[model samples]
Target: MPDTSQKAGGRRNAQSRREDQPMYPATLKVAVIHWVMLCAVASTVAQTVDLSGEWRFKKGDDASWRQPDLVDTDWQPISTGSPWEQQGHPDYDGFAWYRRRFTVPTALRDAEAFALTQSLLLSLGRVDDVDETWFNGQRVGGHGTFPPNYAGDWQAHRSYVVPNALVRWGEANVLAVRVYDGSGMGGLLGRRPLLRAATWREVVRLEWEPGLGDGLFTAPRPIAFQATLHNDSPRALSGDLHWSVEDDEGKELSRSTVAVALPAGRATPAVHSFQPSSPGFYKFVATLEPVDGTKLLFSKFTGYLPESIEAPLTREPDFDAFWKETLATLAAVDPQFAVERKIDRDSATHEVYEIAMRSLGGVRVRGWYEKPKTGNRSPVLLRVPGYGQNMRPTGSDAPIAFFSFNVRGHGNSQQDVSGLPADYWIRGLDDKRGYYYQGAYADCVRAVDFLAGRSELDPQRIGVTGGSQGGGLSLATAALDPRISLCAPNIPFLCDWVKYFKASHWPEMDKWIEARPERTWETTLKTMSYFDTLNMADRIRCPVLFSLGVQDPVCPPSTVFSVYNRLGGRKEFRAYPNDAHRVNGAHRAVLNAWIGREFSRPAK
Candidate 1:
């Protein structure tokens, strides 16, 4: 059984209360009390000035533009928080200038004159590449050196402090920024710029790291709860750090309260350790708040989960029958294979062929077929693509026949179906027979059928491989077709739909579910059971190789293990500790070696 307790502190929002999890609100109750306490010490004195309006933009470099009195009446008007590509400069590179004028608040000027405020911090969000900012006529701050030795901090969030002398009290201030983008999209591509008190923002950072060695946490492992209290305000923060650990189901397992004082303009680190009694998912949440103040310094969440977890199958009653009938329907159609030789994609070692074949519902699917020029019979490797991706020619130099298959609703096959994911994934969900993946899975089986019919390919040594949606199709193809002898799936999707619907990290699924309240969970699960890879796991008889990431939010690691645990074939599994949907390069090397070794062996 897949333990929800294991994912307690996993991906997404930790404080989320699921239908299956317990409803005891230890954190919620504490939050209410904290809110009341924060209401007692109210003091709002800091001021914030918004500088996000239209700015005068001029392309190319000019040192004279940075001057406070420079005129830019002919410059184009552009808004912040949008990339230059979206602002009619799609291919623009090199230096560009953005100039904006804003009036300083009278109150802020008065406070500065009386020396009541610390300093003014200009928050410029994130600038793609490098930038130099000038307030009035003086240089306030800059990130990265310009020109020949340009070292661009492309993803840096810029925060520059303006010197007290630079402020022309209550007057209009000219803020000129010179930005250089090295490649692709650039310019102000993040949050809008703003001017605020240096001591207004306070932050609390939380990180949960394992106290022991990496990889799967088998049982009774120690986890460290690290919290850093940051006091950006000029004042100190004296508060109690209320931290707790809850099972995946939101039941409080442990709690702690530490009274500490945070100094002004500094970060203080606090460390706590807890050993889980057994193996499961748990969440560690920390909230730092002053005893009698309205400022809730921090209430952040992080998880402490096992490396591996398993989920139950959401199997339909006719799971086998549905696929059996679907494949039978595909077999009924004559796969009129249209093979066109592509000279451009061909090499001296391999001959490339663009193949189009008829699949279920008469949809024409496409694939790039590459076979060794000198070989009459070679092992066939069928590669599928990730979600919505078109199948392209393989870059592999392996001595094998490679067929990159693009199922219906993808690549050239989209002539009859939409390529948009939201349109396809939920299409025909009203009936299991008309579900989109039924045709997609049939298309995969048809790809295998095409390989089996080719005389130059070894039908007995055909294998399937892909990542994400491709990974799910790989498993489904091997399960539906007996011609496939080996299969490797990486971070596969469309598995454990029941579990996925409960806590889906993907926005599309949530939006789909939220858009239709009448469908309910029961109806959705029934329709998904037909496409769930977990239900098809038991059907795959070939040697299986699976890889999944521990921190994968799109396809939960627990649901992936459900498919792995249910497989009744020779199989191997690998888990990447700090990966999301994609695995690392080292694992890719191992996967290639494994597939090569599998193809080299005799057909079972």
Candidate 2:
């Protein structure tokens, strides 16, 4: 497949955000972020009232139920997140009424103590079908339509602005929701309902220079951004604005503070200019603490010269020898291969089987295999699974055969070991030989051997692919076994172990390390180096196609590049800038095409 690139990114004010990159005509070729953030603000003004949990519910709707004075003591208590069908209504749909009573604390209604505006947004998440919402006997807003020429969308989320007068501020208030579902699930069906104050997103339109890209740039050129406030309120607002640009490591490179006033009913623009000294990812943050309005926060992540990113190499001197000896030692055991053809799963177009084989420690492992029924010998794709996931038989209609292999400690291979514990990453941290991945990697190689043993499978055309942990296994399998001809890894984990811990964090990962006195990060990472894909990247010579989520906190793109940049083979990658750990369907389409195109070539 030809290398592909296009526009993609996600954004929200001050929340874990993605930035839009602007196209720059300057010869410097840097992507202008058009975003900046405020830092070290004295205060931010906002309030959130959680309205989730149990609420009074009834099977049928009554117009009087919307009244605040109605006594609903006999109504059933039902949770707001799930549909009424799941809360015991069964297939019964049509109309239902939900009522909840809450007290708005005086703290949230104060409009004069430093913060002037206390606008309320009642977020009911996404409700199936249509709903008419009421607060304290007053119809605030609603969504879709009901009956007579019925038209409503299940995908439409419910957010309604509440007028200050109806809130019964600092007093008890009653909320009611009248919903109608023509079929299937009904009632509030997504996130819990809540009321939150409007943030910077409501008052500002942040514009970056050259509006073509989002969160990607070139190095050595100054980054430019400006924040504009809409100031649509009744009076002019004055507040302190704090802004800064920081590197990926959270180190502040530039920062400044200033007091600014925004004129009412107009747009006010505040622009800033700065340049990053080197290539990599940088973040811009801005905060607006309006003296009498809601506090707004902003952050945008941008990348510069990402291709030049380099990670610290921690490969042990005996890394190659360590793996060579282990493989040699494990090969001494008989594989004890077994295959059971599942007649029940077979079709005219494909043959299905449950297969097993022995790997390190003579431990037996299992996987699901499905081969095309054609007599022609075809290339095989060894499919792998992500961390702690169970994989079913891949019935992909693609030209090649698919073997969904599971390493020990996963799926049906739990006979020898099980990934039952959540803290698998930290298990066996003391010994390199005992680490969970040591045996898992060997299990992948053993699967390759099993694939090669099949007379109908083209060993020279075998390709390995998966996401997350499976992605790491794909690279490791190719690195350890010369039989693998093509490798495709997406958002791969288990690379650049030291950096992985720094870029992302998990409560389980931290608790495990903190629980033991002898476990130092230095010693743990030293052992991890043996299985590090970055250390093994140079050994693989097959064509490699990598896809990454640039915003992935689990398997940082920088760490993925450390392995990609070091590969001693033909390699190309497609990046999704806004993704966290998983690449979406966009990458999957490219991967399928890339696999089909690469496998068509003669064996190297």
Candidate 3:
């Protein structure tokens, strides 16, 4: 129940840093930085300056703003590392500019001192969407393709070399940044931007791969920890790389060091194998110290368990009885089905209909339905969406019927109450019967009923698919209703609630717990047991195709793997290394192929 959707802000000032504050001093803030850096090699430069505080900020972009002499009399002050939305410009999107002035340290202002460093480089951490950066009066760097056909690399850290000839040895230098955020959180997000020496760099890249390649490791089975070091400079580099494996609670399980050497433009990877004696998730971290005192670090999260997950099914004995009663109450209500055709959204291959249905508690749920114009009945694809997202037709011209359904309090179904996601997930937490998702889950079942009643659809071939919250809903629907024959839930939420509260970085659920500190963890978890997807995994008998990212912080791999291990039906899973919440094209291809095979199979 943690709030995982918080906007990306200053890395050192973000959740990770706050969590480490109790252990490290302000001067040793770099200790926390060591844990967050994944593959970036730390530069050898010993002397560097951090650029993380207030800067002149403006909402819109201007060409002249990049000029060094431009005065920002009206521009407001904002942090360089936090998103603008999280600050004061919550509603503002599109282009924005950030400007700041800093003079070379008076001690390093000498030309000889500058010559020793050769050329200076600027590290801009990571920017959301797209960005163009300027130093003094010249354009220095740009990341992500810009405008017209814009695609921002939200995860990349920007590091650019500043030309030596343009160095203002003794005078003040100005840095300007232009940014564009398409959706959600925007602006410069990541570690503090800094000025560093562009000398020899040492980077440590680490990955923990299970022998099964499934992102889940069995106890007593050896897991490979692969580490690679890259030398960015055009010279040979050598250093001592130290690595350690730690439990989820931060206890070091194993530690060792390796001497690594890399020629120019070369990478040296070393594999270290370790066998876990216990079950749980562990963090593998590698640290490399270049010539500088600063430590470069990289880490990967891995889980180890028995062939069977030890996660207990923490459901109440009344769980089935409670759901059966709710369904009975829902069945008594008559769903008045109505459809509105969206001609503009329709194509020659398929017709789009905006359909509405009456669900539990008499709430109206809405969905966009698409079916092949062919008269023959086709398999149906019921898609539930991620948290707070409105459902829209997928518009795939494949030979199948599709329904993008929105549950109560979502999209057009928000008649009874607005589904502000932050509030929706934990609504009515104290009581099981009044929980919000009870209605949401009922809406999904009603959607299946609606599909069963349709003459143009095959009830036997009904399938459910979704990601994140939708993925959890897919499992719930398939477990509760036997009508669902196929299920594909990607990076599902709502699994292992008690364990999730401790393993994830999300803090939303913590807010409710903080407000009611009087409520014991046991009581809170008991209420959550009725809704935990881990409790529902065993009830699903349909064939399932599940996918997840190993580095997903929102839905940790341990929790997802627990659900995977508990499935009582035929199931296949795909896992990606170093990926977060989203899946790549190859994973999508696998999912599409799986769905195609299921749809083309002979009906029972």
Candidate 4:
């Protein structure tokens, strides 16, 4: 069995929390202030000045660039809203400098609340690679270390606090930034930058939690997506807590406003009941605002009984007939399955073979097959590849057999597919019969056929698992062929196409629609209906273990849920709230042991 000591304590159904993962905090902070109000808010009123605009830029770094009054006659103009690469230096990298001039209103020095604080907050959105900033020729703040260390996370937000004494109020002041990018797109980017008094977090703090500890609420049970609002100030405050529940597509399902009175220095619980008629993911957004207009906002995601969420089949009437005919066509061609031993790569415990066979439309696919040298029949696991990815033999020392298969257009299996990934998605979009995945799915079926025919493998104990596009392929393969005894998919694609389009964008999808003069979106979706995983979920009766990253944009959590909620029989899912399009090391250990245990069980 795979080692369980890595993480999640190797628990079979652990939803591991990756709290350390960085999330891009909303940098657009309105005045975090105490307000002079007819009602009440904070004791300080925060005024903000937007500093996001065109800035003088240079490709190379120089210590002299930080001067407040340098004649930057030849420096190019660049906007802070986007990376420098997108402006004019698409291929340029390394050190760069950005400078701009602005005034911090002198009137702020006379404001009643201004005397309460000693610093002004500069919100710089996000910077790629690394950045160092200077306000009026003095080092202020920066994130990441410059080379030879060369370490910086592009995702982190950039915020600097400037001492109140440094401000040359109502006078022209220069702000300069030094940036270094090792490679890829780089520069100041993301949200609009601003110079504000403070952020809402500096005063009051807000946090959300589901009513049920596991966040799975039964239908009509009156569940609450509750929030704890803490009043950090010594004085009391009053406000209306507005709560809204949104569906997976961002459609507002319900809203409520409750007046809250906070006692001095105490945390108050804000809650509202939301009843979901069906199972699916939902988001809760809360805004606590007083009459003075100081607002603190926070959001959290949760789901109901996921398996009970109903998504009706959007398949065409000929869905079964279409696949039946495709398989028949594949059956007409001889597989010509062949395997050759690789003596040099064989481990002490197993032997390896380079395998290939003819699949649908006579497209030849390739894979690596390895078996233990115990001279006993072994349960084989089929591992598929992600989009445009090739397959390499895994170096695992497990006793089970492994068949790493690559479809046409991926890795060594590309015999007919030209171009690359973008071309593959749009190819033959007008006709379902000619679509690339039609043959690719058939290629997976042929691999299973080859496995069942092998004497050294137990056909009844076969399993399939993959991530991203491969995750979708595993679902399709298991649905079409019963030989797969266990199925595990992670951050999967090819499910729920209609919602998929709404949640994520693939340029190839746009290109396909634009190139064809007669093809409308309705017609295009009809073709996709034939391949959507939700329509085929009921066909696979085997137990399924699925995982998804809540932050994954490529194959979003919504797309995973559209199909996952419809899955019947034995199934469970683990969501990594902070991950994006990839599985964690802890989940990997869990899968290893789970798969090992599943394969070793008695097959029905």
Candidate 5:
């Protein structure tokens, strides 16, 4: 169970109520509070400089902005309005210029000068790619690389500094933006991209009245946190609030009870205090128990803590010792398949090598490798970039042989495993044997075999890493084959099959669940145990590096953390708060750095 006895210190005092505070305030205080609230509302609803008017756009190979001096019309607006509306055209694959004219307020001429900021926030509410911003024909900051797949999510609001000279403070200003959407649903499909002055309101107003509040909390202590409940409706509502807490390992810690009786249109705050005795990530769930004993109004919260002196680290061996024990355990299970591999060659520039290995079926699997150019025979990293028809070697130079393998169902090896789609997730999910995971795992084992066949690569210096379904393969390979030196899986899917089937809101999984009503979750999950990374993570011997995104609806953070805490080996984890499955370039850099460092260390 979690330890909830830790005192709520200065962090709580920042917003907690004082014992001597009055329930209601004096007239003067009330007046001041009302005035403040009114001011806040007014600021939120203040006139927004709508920059969505008629705009001109052009596409070019270079960044040169054609000035009026070079064009026929100096003041006329050049429009590509019709062609721009027809999205998804092959011509839309490149950059385009967008021009919008807005009249500046004359009264605000002398007011603090502000530059126009253009941001693409939440494109079409589904797909997210990268884009750039320009104001008055001047360059501003942007996230990600230029052109398609620009590295930044549409949900993220990017602000770039505009030159003061470019701003027509009180006159009409021309705002142009060059956007690039690489794949999937490209272009601005939903709402228009927003353009605003530098000085704009940022506070978000959340109104709450009676059943449940937003899923946010502040953990004053390791195990205990407080939550606010509000009743927005005009009637009193009564319900039992059930709260439960679980650690990263899916171990239930402590839970507290609370009953709420909120008046109509009034708000109530409930504080949950639980004990989290562990020093890892913890999840808290609050549910409004139905009168008929059903569950409703569910919300989740997560918290973590650094290691403390009082709680001695669990009696787990260090990474090397753990891997040795893991190998020994797996060896005890089946001595016929010893855990060892060999590397053949190490490249100088491209870091490419070749490996040959005999699979369990006695068929040899081939692999291409790329090791860190740092001149060190560091731990090896085996990667399978998924079933794409053009899967290639990734991470050419790092601290390890970032060997990316094209599994049998993908790339040059597709003939070996046929009938699988280039994109396999949506293909034959109902069939247990023919499912993508089946062949994928075989390819993973082959990858390890290829590594073992090599003479230059170290057998004990092998790790596996990948994302999405590839992540699932990493876990399965590590579980079925103990030769993997370390494992790093990022936002992997296909874990905790029961929970995933129930919690996922995606169309693909929803269709699968509905079509297979006869397939009980228990049966499906049992079958999935063979592929579930979380279940397999515990079986992995090497230290694992896990990364998760808090806002990822696809592979929810809860599932990731569930597997992370249960891993019975040396582990390190990081969560990007506002990111989804595909993280930003900066975060990717951090992940690469961590992998480099982990592989650089000598095997224990």
Candidate 6:
């Protein structure tokens, strides 16, 4: 078996705090303590501790033993375990065990005085689900059942307390674990488990980087505001920063424009102070227009202006020019046929419309629309599909105007763009103008437009739902438009993009790293911020339901929690330890039941 244990002295040195990094003055003391802890942990290794590694594994359905003290020669090396990649073995549903042997270091013989702990981390990739972990011959900790039907915890980390008596100093120790993936893309997609000496430093390192910061709301003041733009790139950049303030009616209040220049590797903060003549709720936006005339970067920040002044609309006739050009470009391309003619009928209980929207970008996007057959108008349910599939409403009999859409490069909607191989991660990657996410957002808006166009549809009662990528779209759409009344995203993707690159091993994301390898981590993250749900969650005006699987390997529960905590509206969440990407049958029942009740009620 290959030794998977980490080298004791090979760990990277602790990182020093970057000078340019922002810090909350009040938390300086806490930050200092974290640095100290990292230093101490890096300097020590526990003596007489047996670290787990050199693992072997086997596939099975039974969990009869908590501790496998007896050796089974039938077991194969975990690295070569069954269910080869092509078979999609186990179909991402089933059970497997990992066993490793380790020898204790003789440095500390008084093992009983110090606590021994074991921890395992798994990454299933894309899908979120539950898992159960074991150590040596004992049940340690797991979110789901020890053997079957375990409720999911959806957490990336699982730990087990080591019995003091189980420590055999200076001897070989066997560590074993059992993992279960219930749905979606499940399996060991990235990273692996290894052993480390547990100490206070380790505990402190875990505590460092206090989750996310709270939203800071400035007191109502003059509309005048200053923006400090920092150009942290190596090459000189030039752009025009367009600024505008708008009222609640979507009317412009005041506007200013500035052209900016920054030398290579420098910082510049532009100050814009303006007074609004009138206000309800105001927004300030800054858009970058590059010198080469290429739309390289587009960024904006919003704030409110007091309603005391009577501000008039500052009309910019040129604004429509951009929209006109965009619309003209879209009209030039023929919309590819998405679906053939189907039946449109009204029954006693439902009104069904066989609908088809062209996949202008090549990926065919298709779906069905069903409304209440009765005279009463029905709310819309905009369902976003997960990775590799188009949205298709399932297991529901409610009267809903369903608009299921395929993102730009998927399904029947592939129009102007070439068809991407089912597994192409970098498809449409080189050109940001045609990237999957760029068109995906547009698809969401088009879906809304389609629903709103129908006279029988109750636009005010429309809602959105999806899992994984679909869940992410739900949050993004809700933030961009207030028309959505409710949203439910399950194990959503594309939250904190910066953190995702560090935590995930999804092969598709490698294109991002390759495009800008030197500052790929930083640049890709900044680009992702434009699409991050955390930044948009505050803008959402509707109620939301967020679900997570504790044992999920792809979308870590912690990341989901980070976004859920930032939501600024009515919100509720559920965590399943044994479940993965798709919730179990029982949980799905609860979800649909809640939706039926909420959607049926009159809008607030």
Model 1 worst lDDT window (10 residues): 2-11
Candidate with more favorable, higher lDDT: 2 or 3: 3
Worst 10 residues of 4 by lDDT: 23-32
User: After best superposition, candidate 1 residue 444: deviation in angstroms?
Assistant: 0.7
lDDT per residue as tens, model 4, 389-436: 666565456777888788887777877665253356567878999898
Candidate number with the higher TM-score (3 or 5): 3
Candidate 6, residues 89-187: lDDT per residue as tens digits? 433455666566666555543432243222121212211235555555665455544335455433344544343355565687666655554432233
Query: Candidate 5, residues 542-604: lDDT per residue as tens digits?
Result: 777776665455566666666665677888766665455543334444556766666667777
Best by TM-score: 3
List of clashing residue pairs for candidate 4:
33-44, 33-46, 34-43, 34-44, 34-45
Two-way TM-score contest, 5 vs 6, winner: 5
Tens-digit lDDT track for model 2 on 499-568? 6776655556566678889877788788889989988888898999998866666677767877888886
Could you estimate the TM-score for every candidate?
0.61, 0.67, 0.69, 0.62, 0.51, 0.45
lDDT per residue, candidate 1, 1-604, as tens digits? 1111111111111122211111111333355588967743421344567889799998899888899899888899998887776788865778999998988776875553124335677889777668998898778778766878776554456887664567776888899999986654568754568876454332223334432323355544476656566554455668788777765445688888989887865778888667776544455667667523443543322334433455666776787777778878888999999999999877556789999989899998899888888766988888886676666665345677788788887777787776754256777776898888888888998898889989988888998988888789999998888889999888888787866655444454456677876775578778988888888889899999888766665676667776777888799888766555664434555776788788878775
After superposition, candidate 1 runs with Cα above 4 Å error: 1-208, 211-215, 220-242, 246-255, 259-280, 287-310, 374-376, 505-518
Model 2 worst lDDT window (10 residues): 5-14
**Models ranked on TM-score:** 3, 2, 4, 1, 5, 6
Q: What are the lDDT figures for the candidates, one per model? A: 0.70, 0.72, 0.73, 0.74, 0.49, 0.50
* Cα displacement (Å) at residue 292, model 3: 1.6
Q: Any idea what lDDT model 3 has?
A: 0.73
Better of 2 and 4 by TM-score: 2
Better of 1 and 2 by TM-score: 2
Clashes in each model (backbone N, CA, C under 3 Å)? 11, 14, 7, 5, 30, 45
- Candidate 5: stretches off by over 4 Å: 1-172, 175-348, 351-368, 371-379, 386-390, 418-436, 505-518
**True-vs-predicted CA distance for residue 326, candidate 4, Å:** 1.1
lDDT of 6: 0.50
Name the best candidate (by lDDT): 4
